[model samples]
Target chain A: MNQIDGKSARALLLILSTFTYLLFGAMVFDKLESEEDTRVRDEIERITDRLKNKYNFSERDMHLFEAIAIKSIPQQAGYQWQFAGAFYFATVVITTVGYGHSAPSTSAGKLFCMVFALFGIPMGLVMFQSIGERVNTFIAYSLHKFRDSLHQQGFTCLQEVTPTHLLMVSLSIGFMVIVSGTYMFHTIEKWSIFDAYYFCMITFSTIGFGDLVPLQQADALQAKPLYVFATIMFILVGLAVFSACVNLLVLGFMASNADEVTAANREPPSAIVLERFARNSLVESQLFNIQKHSTVGVLPGRPRRMYSIVPNSAGDVHLRRRSTRRSIQDTVCCGCFKPRPPRYRFSLTRRPTNISHLVDLELY
Target chain B: MNQIDGKSARALLLILSTFTYLLFGAMVFDKLESEEDTRVRDEIERITDRLKNKYNFSERDMHLFEAIAIKSIPQQAGYQWQFAGAFYFATVVITTVGYGHSAPSTSAGKLFCMVFALFGIPMGLVMFQSIGERVNTFIAYSLHKFRDSLHQQGFTCLQEVTPTHLLMVSLSIGFMVIVSGTYMFHTIEKWSIFDAYYFCMITFSTIGFGDLVPLQQADALQAKPLYVFATIMFILVGLAVFSACVNLLVLGFMASNADEVTAANREPPSAIVLERFARNSLVESQLFNIQKHSTVGVLPGRPRRMYSIVPNSAGDVHLRRRSTRRSIQDTVCCGCFKPRPPRYRFSLTRRPTNISHLVDLELY
Candidate 1:
C-alpha cells in the first residue's frame, strides 16, 4: 500500500538525515575542540613543569605528579573526533543516553548537539519503536510457537496461554541476563558480585550512571572502539528484552480482570490481536486487545458468564455479556496433572459501562 | 468508571509496592555497604597518618596526595542509604535515566534495582503518559482558543488551523526553551553560550553526558539534597516537553502526505485528529480516516484517480481506486501565507498491489 510505502520512505529519510547530522557533528566537534584540548593539556604540562622546577622534585616525584596531572585532565586528548569516540558520541547523541564520560566540548559541538538532537531524539524513538516492536512481536511469536509445541507434544492442552505465564518466562529470562552480566563483569573488573550486578542493572536500564563504567584497565582501554561496539550490542539487546518483558506486563495488566461466567456452552478463546494505538506506549496498546474476547480464563471451552466492558464512541460504553453458570475443570501445570474446580460463587455486582468505569472496577 | 478506578488503584498499588521495595533496599544497603565504606576510609586514614610520620613529607605535598586519595575513592562516604540518596535512587530507578553519579553498591541494592525497575519503569511510563497527554491536550485546547479568538478578530476566515501552522508554532516554542535554558545554564556555570546549550541538549535529551553536570558549586554541593530535587524537576519537565514535541512531529509526518482529490471547489483545511494513536506515533491510523475529511488538497467533491492497495485477510493485496482528479489550491504558511496550486503533473507509474512492490519504488 502507498501508506506503508510512504511511511517506510519517510522513516528512511529520517534515518539518513540523522546519520548526516551525526557525521556533521562529529567533524565539527573534532575540528573545533581538538585544539582547545591540546591547549589545556599544554597548560597542564607547563604548570607541572614549573612545579617540578620549584619543588626540587626527584625523577620519581616528577613521574608521580605527571601521572596525577594526566589523570586529572580530561582523557579525551586528541582522539575525540576519531572513529571510536565519534561513533560512541553518535550512539550517545541518538539514544539520548548520555554516558557523560565523553561529550562534545566546543561551542560548535554544543550548538550542533542542540540542533542535532532536535531531529535525532524523535528519529531515535522511531528507530526504537520500529526495532522494539519487531523484537517484541518476534519474541511473542516464538513464545507462542513454544507453547503450541508443548501442546502438540502432549505437555498440556490449554485453551489460551495467559499473560501471567508469558511474564514469568520473560522475567526469568531477564533475571538470567542480569545474573550472567554480573558474572561477566565481576570476572572482568574483579569487583564484588554486588558491584557487578549494580553496574549491569544500571547499564541495561539505560541509566548509564557512569559511576561504574568499564574498561578502565589500561590494556582494555586500548580497544575502546571494540568496547563501545560490544556495549552498544549489550544495551540494545538488553533494552529489547526489557521491553518484551514490559510488553507482557502491559498485556497482563489489560487482561487480568476479565470476570468470566461458566455455562454449558462457549466459543474457543481467540488469539490476542495486536492493534495499533498511537502514543509512546507501543507495547501497552499492543497488550491486551478486547475485541471479541469472552472468557480469558484457563479453560476456554467451559461455558462461563463473562461481563466485558468495551469502550465505544459517542460517550457510551458497550457492555457485552457471555453468561453461563456451570462449574468447569481446568488441568494446570503445577507438577502433575490435576483438575482444578473453577469458582463460580464470586461475581461482580457492579457492571461498568465505559473505559473509566472498567478501570474503576480494578479490572486492569 | 470502574475500569479507570481499577487502573488507578492498580497504579497506586504499584507505587506502594515500589516504595516498600525502596525502603527495604535503603535499609539493607545502609546496613551492608556502610561497613565496607568505613573500612576503606579507616585504611586511607591509617595510611595517611603513617605517611605523615614515615617521611618528612612537606605539608603541601601531604595535602596534594590527600586530595588525590579522596578523589580516587568511590565518593560514597557513608551517605549512600540516606533518605536524600534513596529518593534520588528511586527517581533514577523509575526513569531509567541513571546518572550513575551515585548507585547502590551492595548485592541487596543491586537486586533491588532489578526488581524495582521491573515495575517502576511501567509506572513511570504511565505517569509520563498521563502528564504528557494532559499537557498535550491542554496546549491544543489553548491553541484552538487562540485561533478561535483570531478568527473572531477577523484575522482570517479559515474554519480550521492547519497542522503545519500549529507545528511551526510548537517548534518555535521548543526552540525558545532551548535558547532560554542555554542562557540560564551559561550564567550559572560561567560557561560559553554554546557549551551551556550543549549541556542543556544533552541533559534534557536524557543522554546526560556527565561531562557537564550541574550544581557543582561548593554551596550547591553542600545543599545536595535540594540540588537533586531541583534537578529531578528539571529532568521531568524537560522530558515532558520533549515528548510533546515528538508527539507533534509524529502528527505532522502522519498527516502530511495526503493523496486528496481536488473538486471544482473546496473547504478549508481541518486539524488533524491526533486523538488516539496510543503509541510513539500519535498519528498513523489517523491520516487514513477519510470519513470526515473535507479539504484533502487535490479535490473536494470530485474524487481522485488514485490506486490504493489494501491488504486482505488471505495474504492478498487488493487494489482499489476512486478516480477523477481536478485542480485544487492549498494555503500554506512559510513566513507569509500564500495559496499554492496543487500539482497534478506528478503521478505514479507501476501501481503496486503489494507492500514489497511499493517498497521497490524507493519514494524517499
Candidate 2:
C-alpha cells in the first residue's frame, strides 16, 4: 500500500512538471516569434487588400477566391489519393508523424483511416522497437568481435562492449542519417540547408508540423519517383535508428531508477552475512538451491518439477534434482483465491564467474 | 548467439509485415478516396479558372493572390504567436499531435522548438506512462479494498481485481471522454457530429491531421478562452486515460509473449522434483536460501552481505544468516572482467502467501 502511494505521488509530481515545462516553452516561443508572426500577418493582409483593389472583386467572390486558392494548394501535388501518394499518407499515419499534407476528404475514407491506424500504430511501434533492439544487439556483437580481434593481435585495448559503447555507436549512426538526409533534401527540394536540417529534425522526431512538407511543390510526388522513394526510406530508416538510441537510453535510465527505488523502499535485513567472490577468481564449489513456485497458472493437485543448479567451480554448471516428498494441501477459498502478504528479503552473495548467465535467469 | 539470431529474424519479419500492411492500406485508401479526390480537384480548378476569366487578371497577379490567400488562413485564427496560441502550439508539439495549424515562422523559434522538443517529448512520454501506471494501481487497490469491505459486510460476492477489469474500466473512461469531447466540439465549433468525433479521435491518437482542427474556426484561441482551456484539458486528460488503457493492454500482451518465449527457448531439464502447495494452503518450513551474487556493482575486494529467508510455518517470515569463512581468489583479468556462460535452471517449489512480493523481486 505504501509502495502504491509512493508511485502515485511520483506520478502526480511528473504531471505537474510537464505542465510547467509546457508553460515555459510557450512563454519562450511567444517572446521569440510574436513580432515575426505579426509582420507576416500584416504583409499577407496588405497583399490581399492590394489584389482586391486591383481586381475590384465583390466580398462573396473574394471569399470564394480565397477558399478556392486554399483548397488548391494540396491538389497542386497531383492525385494525392493515387497509389504513390496514398502509400506516403499511410506511412505518415502509421508513424503518427501525420504531416497532414493530404487527408481523407470522404467520410468513408476517414472511418477507414481511424480503423487502420488503430491497429497500424501499435504494429508500427512494436516493429520499430524490434528493429531497434536488433540494431543495438548487432552493434554490441560487432564491438565484441572487434575487441576479440584486437586481443588476438596482442593489443590489450578496446575491451568488452558496454552499454555506453552501444549508445555511442547508435548516436553516431543517427547523426550520420540526419546529416545525409539534410543534404539530400537540400539538393533535391531546393530548401536552404538550415531549413532542411530543421525539417529532418522535426520529421525524425515525429512532430512533423508540415509547414514545409516535401513532394508538394512541382507535383514531385508523381514526377520524381526516386526522390519520393528516398524520402520515404529516409523517414523509415531514420526512425528505426532513433528508436535504437531511445531504447538504449530508456533502459539505462530505468535501470538506475529501479536501483534508486529499491534502495529507498527496501526494509533492512535482520541478519547480515558477508560473502566475497572477486572477478577472475576461480571458485572451488558453489551450489544454488533454486526454488520456484507456481502461483497463477497450474492445475491444482498436479505434480510440479523442481531443480537446483550445482555449479562445479572448476567445471560446467550442473542441474540436480533433490528427491523430497512434501505433503500437499488445498484450501480453495473463493475461486481458490489466496491473499499473500508482502515479504521482501534482500541478499548479496557471490557464486559464479558469469554475470550474464545470472541475468539470463530472468527467462524463468 | 542463437537467441540473438532468432530475435534478428523476428525483427526482420516484423519489418516485412509492416511494409505489407502499409501497401494494403494504401490500396484500400486509393480505392475509397481517389474518385472524390478527383472531383474536388476538378471543382477547385473550375472555380479558379472562372475567377481568372471574370477578373482577367495577369498570371503573376493571380499567383500572388493565391499565395496571399493561402498565407492568410493561419492568420484568421488571430495572432498565433500570442501567449494562448503559443501555449496551445507547445502542448501540441510535446504531445506530438503536431496539428500544423501554426508552426514557428522565425529561425530562432524553429531552433528553440527543436531543442524544446528534444527534451520535452521524452519527458512527456515518461510522465504519461507514470500517470498511467499510477491509475492502474489505484484502480487495483480500490477494487481490492472494495472486495474486502464486501466480505466484511457478509456479502463475499466480489473477487479480486484482474487486468481485464482494469482494461475495461480504462476503456470506458476513454470512451466517455471521446463522447463528451465530440459533443462539445460539435456544439461549440458547429461541426457535424461525425466530423467532431473524428477530430477527437485524431487529436487523442496524436495524429492531428489538421483537416478539421478545433480552435482555428472562429479565432477561438484568442476570443474564446474558456473553450480553449477546455480543449487543452480534453487533450491532456484524454491522452493520459488512453495511456492507462494502453499500459494495461501492452503489459498483458508482453507478459504473455515473455511466457511463450521462455517456454520455447528454455532447454529441457536434466532432472525433476515434484512438489505441490495448493491455493489457500499454509506453506510450512519453506526455507529460501537466497544466494545473492553481486554481479556488476560492488567495490573489488569489498565484503558483500548475504541473507537467507526462513518462512516459519506458524509465524511471519524470518531472516537468518549462517556465518562461514571462505577464502577468495582475485583473478583480476583485463578490468577484472569475468565471462559467465549461459546457465538456466528450472525449479518449482512452495513459497509464502505473497505473489506480489515475489514479483517485486525485479526491483533488485
Candidate 3:
C-alpha cells in the first residue's frame, strides 16, 4: 500500500475501533444503569409530588424554588470565588479535572476561563509530561542502581532494568495514591469506603463526574485548608504518576507495533529502506558479533577508508570514523557524539538502544 | 550540572511555574467572580427565605426539598442511562469531559465505570492521536501539493509549506469548529451566544464544568437523535483539531529548545557526542557544500576508504554507502532508509529533518 494511504487506513482503523468501543460501552451502560436510572426517576417524582402536596406550593413557585436550590449548592461551600476555592478551581481547570461543583457564573469569568485554558492546558500538559518522564527515568535509574547493588552483593540473578520494571513501579505508586486518597476522603467526608474509592478513581482518571465532589460539604473549601491542600496534592501527584504509566505504555505500544510491522511483508518502502539502513549501519559499525549472520562487503577505492565498529566494555557499539590523513589517536567515536542532552524529552527516544533517527542538521 | 540534577531542577522549575500560575489565576478569579458570586448567594438567600415564610415549611423539610430538587434535575432530563444518553455518557467518559449531567449511582455501575475508563481512556487517547497526526500530515501534504501546483503555474511567490502554515491552518479549523458549535447550541438550545461559546471552549478543553452542559434540557439526549449526534461529533472533532494544533506547538517548542541548547556551552556530553557524530556522518558523506566552514582531514592508514556525502537534486542530503565488492548500481541512499514507515508516529520524529536517533538493534 502507498504510504499516505496506509497512514490514512490506520487512522480509519482506529476510528472504527473507537466507535465500536463506544457502542459496546453504551450497550453495557444502558444495561447496568437503565434500571437504576428508572428507579431514581420514579423516586424523584414521588418525593417532589409529596413535597408539593405537603407544602401546597404553586407549580410556578416550586419551579422557582428548584432553580434557587440548585444555584445555592455551590454557595453552601462558602465563598467559592475566594482565594482557596479559586485556587482549587484553577487547579481543576489546568488539570482538566473540572468537577463542576462550582463554576463561574459571570460571562467575564467564563471568558477568562476560556483564555486561561487556552494557554494553561498546553502548559499543564508539557509540565506534567516532563515531570512524568523524569519520574520514569528516576525509577529506571533507581532500579539500575538496585540491580548493581544486588550484583555487588553476589546476586547475579537480577536482569537489567527494563521499561516493564519502570511501568510496574509507577503503577504501584499510582495504586498507593488512589488507596490513600480513598482513605483520606472517606475519613473526612464521611463517605462509605466504596464510595470514596469510586471518587478517587473518578478524580484520578479525570472523569470527575462531580457526582461526589470533595470539599463541598460543611464549607470544607473555606474551613479546612489542610484537607484542601492535601486534595490538590493528591490530584497533581496522581496525574503525574498516571502520566508516567502512560509514557511507558506509549513506548511499549510503539515497540510492539514496530515488531509487528517487521514481521509483515506489507511494509512501507521508506520503513524497509530505513530498517535496512539501520541494519547496515549496525553491521558497518560492527556493533555486535554478527558476521556469521550476515555478509558485509568493503567498498573498494584507491583512497579507501575502513571504519572499524567495535563494542566497548559496556556492550555499547562504538563506530570509529577516521579521515585518511588523521592518526588513529585522532579518530572520533560516532556513537557518543550527541549534540546535547535533550531539553524536551519524550520517553520514546530517551532510551539509548532505540536510536534510529537521523540527526537534525538544522540543530547541528 | 549532573544529568540527574539537571533533570530534577527542570522538573522543579516547571512545578514552581505552575504553582505561580495557579496563584495568579486564583487572584484574577477572585477579582472577577467574587462580586457576582456574593450577589447570587444573597439573592438565593432572599428568595429562599421568602419562600419559607410563605410556605411555612420547617427547616428540615426545606433541606429535604433542596436535596430533592438537586436530585430531580437529572431526572427531569428523562432516563439518562437509556441508549442515547448512555452513548453520550460513554463519549464524555473516554474524552474525560465528565459533564456530570448524569453519573452512575449504583455501586456496580460505578465499579464498571472505573474499569471501563481504565481501558477506554487510553484507547480514546491513541485513537484521537492517530487521527490528529494523520489530519496534520494530510494538511501538510495538501499544502505541499498546492504550492507545487502554484509553482508550476509560474507562481513562484508561494513558498514550501512550513510548520507555521500547518499550525495556522489547524488553529483556524479549530476556531471554525468552536464558532459553528456556538452557533448550533445558541440556536437549538436557546443559550446566549457567549454562553454557547463558553460551553464549547470548556467542553473542548475537557474541563467540562458541567454548569452549562448541552442536551440536558428538553430531554434532548433521548428526544433529538440528530442533535445528539451533532453534539457528539462536535466534541470528537473539536478534540482532534486541538490535538493537531498541540502536535505542531510541541514540535515547534522542541525545535526552539534544541536551538537554545545548541547556542549554550553548558550542554550534556551525550548530546554533544551525538551531535558531533551526526555532523561527522554528514561530512563523511559530503552531504553539503560546507567544506569552507570546516577543515577536512584524511587519516593516515592502509585499506583506506573515503565516503562521499552528496546533496540530491531535491536538496535532501543522501549518504551513498557503496561497498567495493559491488558496482555503483548497488549504492544505497542512507537518507531514505526509514525502517517501515513508523506505525506509532509521534509528530516529533516524523519529519525527515529531525532524525538523530540511533537505530534499535533489537528491532533490527
Best DockQ among the predictions, by candidate number: 3
| Candidate 1: stretches off by over 4 Å | A1-82, A114-118, A224-229, A247-364, B1-93, B104-119, B157-159, B221-231, B250-364
Per-residue lDDT for B351 in model 1?
A: 26
Task: Give model 1's docking category.
Answer: incorrect
Give each prediction's DockQ, rounded to 2 decimals: 0.09, 0.28, 0.30
- Best of the two (1, 2) by DockQ: 2
Tens digits of per-residue lDDT, candidate 2, B10-65, equal 89899999999999999999999999999988899898889889999999998898
Query: Each predicted model: what fraction of the native A–B Cα contacts (within 8 Å) does it retain?
Result: 0.18, 0.60, 0.62
lDDT by residue (B1-364, candidate 1, tens digit) is 4222443354355435433433343343334333443454455456445544655567886555434433322221223334444554466556666655555544445565667665566556545544444445555555556766886798865454444554566566667777876776687668788777776666666677666655544434335565556655666666656656555554333223111111212222223323221111222342233211212221112222111211111011000111111211121121011221111111112222222222323222
Model 2 residue runs over 4 Å out of place are A252-364, B149-157, B252-364
Q: Candidate 1, after superposition: displacement of residue A122 in Å?
A: 3.4
Candidate 3 structure quality by residue, lDDT tens digits, B1-364: 5334566788889899999999999999999999999999899999999999999999899998999999889888766899999999999999999999989988888988999898899888878767776767666656656776887899977554445566688899999999999999999989999999999999988899899888888878878999999999999999998877765555334323322312221122222222222232223333222211111111111111212322231222111212211212122211111221131232243442344343333422
DockQ, Cα level, model 3: 0.30
Better of 1 and 2 by lDDT: 2
TM-score of chain A of each: 0.49, 0.71, 0.72
